[model samples]
Structures are given as C-alpha cells and as structure tokens.
Target: MTTALIADDEAHLAQYLKQQLAACWPELEIVSVARNGIEAAEQISAWQPELAFLDIQMPGLNGLEVAQGIEGATRVVFVTAYDDYAVEAFDAAALDYLLKPLKTERLLACVARLKAALGRPPAVDESRLAETLQRLLAPPVQGLARLRFIRAASGDMTHQVAVDEVLFFHADDKYTVVRTAQGEHLIRTTITDLAAQLDPEQFWQVHRSTLINLAHLVGTRRDEMSRLFVRIKGHAQELPVSRAYVHLFKAM
Candidate 1:
C-alpha cells in the first residue's frame, strides 16, 4: 500500500480532502495529517512517506520548506489558494499543484501523472528549480519569494526579525512599515518591494501601499461608503479593504 502524508492548516479542509482521497483511491493509506508546515516537516522526516500533499501557505514554515526538509525521496503535490499568476514557479520547478476546492478530475489526473512519472524517470527539472529558487531570493513578482533578515540597531541589537512574522507591509510617509505582533517597525523599502518578497497567499495587496495578512483577518464589515473594513486580531484599529480586493475575503 502506498503511504501518504497530508499537511493543511485548516482542519476541516484537511478532513474533507482525506475523505475524498480515501474514497477515490481506496488502496492508498494515509499516514498522517499535519496542521502546520512545521509539524508536517517533522512528521515527514520521521515517516518518509512515498507521497505528500501539502498546502503551500501556512504559519511558520510553508510547504516549500517542508518539501526541502524531507530526508529521503518522496513525490510532492502542492495544494493552495494562491492565484494562477503565482503558479508559474511551480510549473518551472516541475512540481504539481492543485487549486482550492480541488476538482476530482484534477486530483485524479495529478495522481495518474505521479504514478506514470514515478514508474519511468524523474519528471522534475532540477536546473530549472535551482534557477527559479535563485530568482526567488531576489524577490520576483508572480514567483517564489524569500525573506530578508533584519537586525535591530539599538537596545536589542542582537534581535533579528524574521520576515515571516510580519503581518502587513504599509507605507508610513516615506518609509515602509512592517506590522507584526510585537509592533510596527520602519524599514527603508517600498510597499511594492515588500509585497514582491511576501508570499501572495499570506499577504494581499488591498491598496496601492497596504498589504494585509490573511491569517490576521478577524472579520470584515462594509462601511457607509460601501468600502470594506477588515478587523485584525491583536490590533485595535480596522484597516480599509479596497473594493477591488473585497472578493478575496468574501467566502472566508
């Protein structure tokens, strides 16, 4: 029996996907369901499953981190709600991806492709993957994004800020500010530049100079002008959600 590991932050989605997989492929045995990519990485390293279906966006380490951390050989399939514009890197890397509310046909096709690819030869392009990752480090739009390390200049000079903790990137006058649980910190960068460095699924461009984190969104309400206002947890104020970007937060 083929062993599989699934990693998704949403419990309901994970359970639903597990049920669908078991129904469609009865012969497959699921070894684990990880709630976060960090947990997924640990479980995957220990289990070394033959197949892994991972969600590309999660708190802490994302799916790519989990995939890279696996010890032995294993085929990886990514599932995410990121836009098609951002999927080109996956294609260039020769890895498979499924969009949200996964279609049965697409799932089956990916499974079939995996089986066929496994039987013959390595299907991924290692050179292209390397090139794509290298480009990601420099912050490319619609592609893999990397984080920059920041060090505090004064009191806590040893404190290094991991870019992943940032909840939003906003323009405050001339400098850009990265908001996080700790507080906002000013940085010498443009909001556009920071957006390109952030994962699209985690950070959304609501306005010309504001990017909000999807995970931090508590609730959304319509203002008198029909504009949406998104309330974030741990923050006292509600931020404006542009009309053009309101659709992204509707169902969720």
Candidate 2:
C-alpha cells in the first residue's frame, strides 16, 4: 500500500482532501496529515512517504519550500488555490498540479499518474525548484513589506531604520515599540494594522503584540508544554512561537 502525506493550512480543506483520497484510492494509507507547509516538511522528512499532497500557499515556508525540502523522497501533487510562478515552474519541471478546491476526478487522475510514475522507475523532475525556494526565502522587497520609521526623541536623529533590521515590534497601550539593530524607538502603529501591511512572507505574526522577521530567525525549540520559542537577532530575549505559527519552522 502506498503511504501518503497531506499538508494544507485549513483544517477543513485537509479533511476534504482526506475524504477525496479515501475515495480515489481506498487501498492507500495516509501516513500523516500536516496543517501547514512546515509541518508537512517535517513529517515528509521523517516518514519519507511515497506520495504527498501539498498546498502551494501557506503562512511560513509555503508549499514549494516544503517540496524542495523533501527533494527526492516523494512524488508531489501540488494543490493550489490559484496558479502563479510556482505552477509555471512545476509545469516546466514536468510535475503534476492539482488546483484547489480539489475535484474528485482530477485527484483520481493524479493518483493514476502517480501509480504509473511509481511503476516506471521514478523519473524525478530534476528542476530548479530549489532555486525558486531560495528566492522565496529571501527577504521581501521594500514596498511589499510593512515598514516603520524610527526617529530619535532628541536632536539630529535623521536616519530611519528599515523594518527588516527590526528584531521585534511590541505593541504598547497606544504605540508600537520597534526594536532594531540600532536601538528601540516608538512608532504609532497597531499590531493589527502592521500585520495587514506587512508581507506575510517576511514578517510573521507570532503573537498579538509581536511580529518577527523570518530573516532574523536564529533558532526554534520546544518548551516545557511542547510550545515553541523563536530566537531572533538584535534581541537577547526569546519569543514565543505560538502553535498557530509553529509551522513556520517545520521546513527550516
């Protein structure tokens, strides 16, 4: 029996795919279900399943990153809400794409192709998906990211720090404290507003009062309660990595 892993952010969507897979390939064994790309990567790496159903977009690592992370281990059937550069890359790489919400017929067809591909000595798509992932991991562009200008309360503080340099942004009662390589400064912004403005790829909403730059990420390890903590540069304090955001490091 073929073992499979399914990864998607939405719990309902993952459930839907589970049902579809059960119908399409009753004999198949689903080894694991991951709620996000990062979790998927960890499970895929650990289980090394023969087949994986991966969603193309997610909060932290994204589907492409997870796929590239599990390079030669499994055959991928990409499930994406919409097509983009990643889809084009997948097509060029000769891998299959399954648009979401996954249709039963399309899923069955994909399974059939996977079975065929498995029969033939797996023809791995030796494409540049790794390079694509590297690009995705890079710090996002200026306009695409949310930035705060920091000024000194005293004289001659003309330089404004880029948001990328920030270690963390804390929300006070009426102001947001922006901490960076240089120092901390007060900015008039709300965590909610900043979250909306920030690029999801660059800055992760770790908590209600905190936003962290993935580029500055140093390490993540489970605490006493199986909760995760993230360490960042420019700050000695380790921040909480909520379960909601835990998937961010699964691939890393």
Candidate 3:
C-alpha cells in the first residue's frame, strides 16, 4: 500500500522505471508521474507520497531543489544518469541513488532497503529533511523572515494589509491582486516572490498564478467532469485548483 511518485524529464526513462518498479515491487502504488521538478514538488506537497524517484536535472527546478521544498513525510530516491551526484545526493539525505540504465539487481537491493525503512518508525519528520537538504544544497540568502504585512496600493492610497487578514493573492497581467474581507488591492510582486515570504502552511499555491490563504478557505466544488475548485470566505467566485495541487484536498 506504499504510494510513490516518479519524476523524470525523459518520458522513456520514466516509463522504464515504472516497468522496473512493477517487477521489483509489485505492491508499491505509483500515485503520479511528473515530467519536471516543479510538478514533482507540487505533487509531493499535495499527495505526500511515501517514496519519490527523482531525476536530478529537470526544468522549473532541479531534483535537489524539489526535494528541499517538500513539506511532507515523503522520502526521496535519486535516479539520474550521472554518478557524480552520488556524494551530493547522500548529502541531501536521499534514501538511495540509482544510476541510469538501471540494473535489476541494484533496483532489487534498493527495494529491500526501502522495505526495511518503511517497516521501521520514521526517525525524522519531513520538515527536518527539507531543512537539512536545503542547508546542504541551497545557497545562503538574506530576507529569510516571513512577511507580517503587505503594502497593497489603490489608485492614490497604499493600504497596509495584515498578512493574516488576506484571503488570497492573484496575479493579474502585470500586477498581483491582494484580496481581503473588506476589499482588493494591487501589488506588483509575483506569486513566486510572495510565496517565499509567506508560510507554506498558511498559504497554498493552488494555481501557477494564485496563492491562497488557507485560513480563508471555506469550501471546494467539483463539476460534472470532476474538476475541482475552491471557495474562499467572502468571495463568490470559486477558484480553480490545478491538477498538480488537487491532491492537497484529498481528505476534504
């Protein structure tokens, strides 16, 4: 019943890994497959799959960066064509590393280790893994503090919106819209930049251009096609939830 995810830019390799995994560990359930690191990260955050097989080099973000940002219990396994990253993969606290043109024997051994690890109680939570991996892989940067307030502008006035009071942040054309219970204001910051300053648990990236405050999330809706959408407090319109983030609401 162990859920897993496979991430690789090479479609053929990803399929090959899936085939090998079926033979090596038939009991393992693959919850999703991602073609890029960004999709991998979003899926991991949403599904919290127990195991993630990741290729180091991918668009949007690298495998190391994706692994460093997961806020869940999912463990990572590096699958790349290069052996040079073996040392750094270990430094990133990857459960195991698999080289390209994967060998049956090696994969079986990895399966054995994964089974052992899963049989035992987790020694560390997902947050610790992320922090450790980030320390090892990411460069030090300033402005690490979370935002407390945002300057939202309207025509001639700039309103200071408390971070907690905001409902959601939406990117519209060139500006990002800041919504609150009272009204909406404009800000020029991108969703990526705003997300970095906000706590991941409080705000969620529901769409590529939208970061919504979980505190204001009232409900979710599904249409005839089973497509999902979210309803926020005081907002009449239901915001669409991208497929990458749909797993986050699985329990809801």
TM-score of each: 0.53, 0.52, 0.56
Minimal lDDT window, size 10, model 3: 124-133
Considering every candidate listed, which one attains the maximal TM-score?
3
Candidate 2, residue 100: CA error in Å?
1.2
Instruction: Compute the lDDT of residue 3 as modeled in candidate 2.
Output: 92
- Put the candidates in TM-score order, highest first: 3, 1, 2
Assess each prediction's global lDDT (C-alpha) against the native: 0.70, 0.70, 0.81
User: Which stretches in model 3 have alpha-carbon errors above 4 Å?
Assistant: 125-128, 141-252
Model 1: ten consecutive residues of lowest lDDT: 130-139
Candidate 1 colliding pairs? none
Candidate 2: stretches off by over 4 Å: 92-94, 132-252
Name the lDDT value of residue 219 in candidate 1.
85
Question: Model 3: how far is 185 from its true place, Å?
Answer: 8.3
Give candidate 1 regions above 4 Å deviation. Answer: 134-252
Candidate 2 local lDDT, 1-252, one digit each (tens) = 989888889989988989888888898899999988668877976887888888878765577656655533477777887767546646533257788767778788888888788777645434344334434444333454354544435355555777767777877656888888777887776665676677678887664457888888898867554656788877888886533344456778
Best by the lDDT measure: 3
For residue 54, model 3's alpha carbon misses the true position, in angstroms, by 1.7
